[model samples]
Target chain A: MASPIIITPAQVATSRDGEVVMLCLSGNWQITASPPRWEQPALDRPLRRIVLQAAAIGDWDSSLALYLSAARTWSGQQGVELVEQGVPAEVGRLAALLAPKPTPPAPQPQLADLVASVGQATHQLWQETKDLAQLLGECAYSLGRFIRGQAQFRWRDCFTEMQQCGALALPIVGLISFLVGVIMAYQAAVQLRQFGADIYVADLVGLSVVREMGPMMAAIVLAGRTGAAFAATLGNMQANEEIDALETLGVSPIDFLVMPRIMALFLMMPLLALYADFLGIMGGLVVTASILDIPSSLYWIETKSIIDLSDLSTGLIKAATFGLIIGLCACLRGLQAERSAVGAGRAATAAVVTSTLLIIVSDAVFAVIFNILGW
Target chain B: MNTASGKSKFAIEVEGVECRYGERVVLTNVSFAVKPSEIFFIIGGNGCGKSTLLRHLIGLKQPVQGQVKYFGRDFTHADRAGRQELLRTFGVLYQNGALWSSMTLAENVALPLELYTQLDRRERARIVSLKLAQVGLAGLEDYYPVELSGGMKRRAGLARALALDPAIVFFDEPSAGLDPITSLKLDELIRQIRDTLGTTIVIVSHELPSIFDIADRVVMIDSGARGVIAEGEPNQLREASPDQRVREFLNRRVAAVQQQQGILHP
Candidate 1:
């Protein structure tokens, strides 16, 4: 029968002799055991050399290498010679691997570099603007081709996109518009009640919901949902070489991929805005009935009287324009995406952010135009 | 001593495997056995289910109707834990290397060792260094996959695949994107790994020089036939295979080069 060998804890002891520092490493130096702590010897004396004595060291692994490398680094920094005595060949080799290699320093930016970067950024932005305009022109040309029945457009794909852009979006659009209606009606009720004119809450909610809130809310929601999806899907296809495959087969990506999505959104956005208007008005009716004691029939009659064809048409037209903006921004970012996973993610984010900004800016422009035209 | 059809002698055995995606059948009635320490090659035309068959062999996808046995144990029917135990012995190199873009080469190689072994950090680092050196990628351990060239990336991926000293290594189009010299070097490395380690190797490739250079036995799968059309030594198949398609595929490069030279010279 063999006896079991007893294990020993690792130890590091430091002693000074003249200008040389002696680091004594002993006992088992396995990583499973707790490592020994050794404080740095004082630098008061001019040290010429440091000796690592591992004569009593037992079975060891990376822990010993780690200790030796630490000593080596300290000696290098202190401008002293390091001497290894009786160390195993394996430990020496492992310790050598731990030695740090020189790396090139990163360049620091200067004033001229900053100016150059700014100039480069401006040039990139100008180029991107031109690309966006060219994409829109290509889309218009493909639409012309479709009208003449000469484009490679699939009705099935267009219908699928319509379903995604319209039907699947209803629940969220309905929810947000309904909440907006409730908030607006509550604010209106607070003020109108002061004058005992609570019945006019119907007129306020109806006009605003139909003219401004409905199209804006629906467009914003679709910008985040459908636009980001378009960018991500196309960006991934680009990464996987599927877009290149389509191009090699003589198919125009604008006619095949972009046209269907844009047409779907253009046709569906007005319908979605109309649906949102109805839901928002219904929410206002609920609030008015409960808080102001107004009957649903009376609220409906007042709402109908206040909201004319002009208000409805204004919201629908804004919605259609917003839809076009979202589609163009998203598809352009998708087509322009670099072929990588990170590029796909950036494309999706850029699509959502850019489309939302454009939607708000276009809505402001429409506000000015409508005001000037006295619609 | 021998029972149950003597399947234990072979390293891998596939019986009547059928591959399909939904209702579209890709391959049917595929059957083959690979002996221990053999270098086998699966060759086929583009989009001909060579990759699909490789996927089945590696237990990535289940065959609709058939059995895949690894060392006489049914891999297709193994439970999660049992399948993981079986998978630990296998290493697969994908067509594009597919090294994690975020990790450095050393970290990529160390991942499998960290997961599967109880080796200490120093020991694992030593093994990682050795494997990279074997693949001729030593001293570039800190380089990320995106920083390396395509050939270097593939070699690093091979190093990672060999991290655990797997019993069987699978290569999918190992020479797909490499120059001829680099691919020939890779073929040499593959043969060296087999000879030194006695590891079973199964490669999926259509590169003709690679097929003839390293393959001990070759199987040709035809897109139209939807199964293995011929199986034998590459040289013998070119000379004597009854299937005209097999002969044409094996001798395609020679005729292609000759016709190209004729056109250029004329």
Candidate 2:
């Protein structure tokens, strides 16, 4: 029997006691003769005792399976005695394959190896890949469930979500867009004055603010404000098992929990973006009127002419799209959040990342479609 | 028990239910019935089909092979409205207590009412405060779940369970991680609810003390191949002769190590 390629941490907890037991490769545990080359020595040094653990691994996928297979085989030949009772799951699964015990002892059970089983190291790899695929599928399925529940949603909950998206977020949206407008107008003044095309600054400000800047700024602000807020709120709920609780309670989580949030963003975002557009243009109007000595009436006339219904509609459409993506991503990340305190931070970060990425991608798609259609 | 309402007369019948996840078979050919108004306890080690069995009772999981009937209704396959109708008559307390952390105590307690009922906000507030008070969290209604201790959160969760005045309440594990004192208090609360409302209760627990304290009859599941090995009043089973599995379970020992006396007395 050749020694299987097993590289485990030199030590592992093999008993139910709080004590950590030692594993001697040659004496206590040994390689066995098997076609698949399990670590068990089937004929002579029948693997008398072993302990398996899930997190205690020192090898990649294949090696981990072989090590587990070896432990399982060795245990099988000897009726599966254990030094690691209440064994961790990874080890528990491995031991289970051999012993076939209906009620397998837990990885940390007192009789160290008393019917213990553990998973192979490959299980972690399997879980990570599986979880990602599962999350994506869950997202799509959740949306399907979402669409069905929309009609049945309680209007009051929608009001509460809209209230938060509008009332609570207004201050931040107003403050930031106001600041951005101030900066844009200041930047436009410096650049336009240099070209002696100072009067044409109206064209530049009106077109940019109405068609692009207004909606873009609004979406970005929301991504930071409401987007982050949605993710954090939902993430905390996920960590606390509130989502699962809702399901157990016979509440349609989508109608009761999500519809209001989506509705809130849908209503507030475009409205806020429209407000930002007006404020942003006024900023440019003020700067031009004061510094360049252009009359306020002239600035207003030029803005009205350059910023038509099409320009305003384009920006509003972009704001609406961005709103959906930002809110969806935030809530998705939140609902999919992890269980730890750090998971909250991670969900917030993921919400920001996913929202920003969606924003840019969506903007690009919108631009192309508009250009093709000559909007 | 008051016995004022016959709601406690509804029984939970889990018949020949089978379920599997992909290739892994989690439950196979399992069956049991929970009597009305009596605390029925499901006791098993982890992964021994304990939670899966509970899901069936609550219509969370539909059996592929058989069905679960709640008071003679075809519950396992019921639609949302049907399930919702059935749910209105009962309460469920999950294994983790599943409180929404974002909402305050009062808000969380009021959620179910807010969902299915048309009570005004003030009315909701009044009922929420009353429920919280029942759980000894009266003034703490504004506290978030994170702000409260584990025991407090569980109590708040209990208040939410009792929010709608259901005819029965189901608990996943009423004393999982709390200290013994808190666990005992929760048990006493369970007893009090039963005494007061005479509500039919189904509890899933492995804690021996809790089982002996609140459960009227304990159903013990041993292995996958072995269905239910024992089902009787906890005190009766504790005193009566039992199979080796039942005896080991009652004594909280490793069943495999002990041999059956096999005199056909059990």
Candidate 3:
């Protein structure tokens, strides 16, 4: 029969040897029974050593090791030595193994480390730029080959990409364009009415929507939607070594993989931009007629008088450039992706960021040039 | 030479390493070392973290504790120059034979040469052919990975891994998805590559036959122990291990075959 665990301070007595303090423990040393608390030995006492009287320890488990470990720690802090011989050999070994090592302090970032990281990042950026330029050159060469009927890509692929990039993008594009136009007209009406100039609201809405907002909004939507899709598809294929297979087959990946998608987006963006212009104008017309108390016929007349062929052509041109940017960035990032699952996701994110940035920068440059030419 | 003491001249040393995926600890307290030109095999049951250990050694992962070293230099803590030197010396063949799908076999072989070496186009092409020929893929240079059989894809992947004449190569489950005959051929090819190039090869596989045939030394991990339970020559472990768990694992196939025979006869 197993004895019940019992721990009492009275049972802990000084040994016949004056230097030792002994703890007498009986029965099962399990946490299920309340284990005895071992007090920290007094530093001022003549206690030079602490020992466990484990002769009565029956059916003990890890709780015994924990209690011994606590006693050892307390003894060490009080300049008292813990004699391991008194404890069961198994308990001693277990306590030693389970002891935690002191953790080292975390390293602080140094100025030198910061400078080195900056240097590394700059070099990486320069390398990426060179790679992107090389990819663009290769893509251009493939396009030339395509024009001369030398490229091997199927016409069916080009048409499929076109349908996916353009037709499939319509609903979201239409909804965004409508909301943008409505917001623009609502904001413009509040300002125009301040001077009783509400009649000029159509001119502001028509010119801004046709020349800038329509194409820019449409390009942003596509950058997030179509550009990310292209990156994800090609990046997944790259991870699976599908891209490597194309190279090994003596096929130019740009011609076989990228050319079709680029051609589709390049051909479709201007048409999509024109459609967005119509939707945005209709949205503005709804706000103008209902909120501004303007007649629908007069609103159309005002819009027609303010918008011209130059404004429409400029927006279409911008749309084409944005399409080229999105296609190039997406394909380049996808091709450069590492061979892993997370790598494909990272490539898609990079494609969206690069396409969005390039679109905004190119748009600014175009605005400056168009202003100079008075387009 | 004891690797834990940091006194051995080892090609790679993995000491007291632990691997975890999120909340689940996969492996713990694992330690081993490989010498130069040794064919080291890691064998384990399903989900025992054999591939995870390989990834940690290849620098694709950081161990939750402990460290991996290449010739006394810590892999994870190494500087960029040290890492580049390590990469240039190492080649990896992933399980699925990750050849770029868009490239021809010849072009795939030419890529690392183009990136890391200054060899001209003709020289690069010649080397590509030589490596392909080494893998018995001499004339199929224009074929894509998608067009190849499972064994052929692994062979092509091996060819690509050897492109830069790496000092060490790692293969993950090279016999997976291959028939017995094809797997035997692959084992022979792996031995040939090692003998000819004198490259240290680290293979993670559960194929007992291949392990016995190709491994200079084998380490068997236990999911229950959460660490390696046996380490020795395959024949030595099969014949002399005192642990019943090790004996059971080594004789598992024989026991299965006997049971099948018993069922058939009865």
DockQ for each numbered candidate: 0.02, 0.31, 0.09
C-alpha lDDT score of every prediction, in listed order: 0.86, 0.72, 0.82
lDDT over C-alpha atoms for residue B107 of model 1: 82
**Strongest candidate by TM-score:** 2
lDDT of 1 by residue, B1-266 (tens): 01123248887888999998668899999999888789999999999999889877877568999989877889888885667667766677877676755458898788677756789999999999999999999999899887989899889878987887877788989999899999999999999999988888999999999999999999899989999999989999999999888988898834455554322241
How far residue B55's Cα lies from its native spot in candidate 3, in Å, is 16
Native-to-model Cα distance after best TM-score fit, residue B2 in candidate 2, in Å = 14
Query: Between prediction 2 and prediction 3, which has the larger lDDT?
Result: 3
Candidate 3 TM-score over all chains jointly: 0.56
Fnat for the candidates in order: 0.00, 0.47, 0.16
**Model 3 agreement with the true structure over B57-115: per-residue lDDT tens digits:** 77666788988887677876778556756666677787878887656999878877875
Cand 1, B chain, TM: 0.92
State which candidate, 1 or 2, has the greater lDDT: 1
Across A210-309, the per-residue lDDT of candidate 3 in tens digits comes to 8898889889999999899889889998888566544433356798779888888888899888888888988889998999899989989999999999
Ten contiguous residues minimizing lDDT sum, candidate 1 chain A: A241-250
Full candidate order by DockQ, most accurate first: 2, 3, 1
True contacts kept of 1: 0.00
RMSD values for the candidates in order, in angstroms, are 20.8, 13.2, 14.7
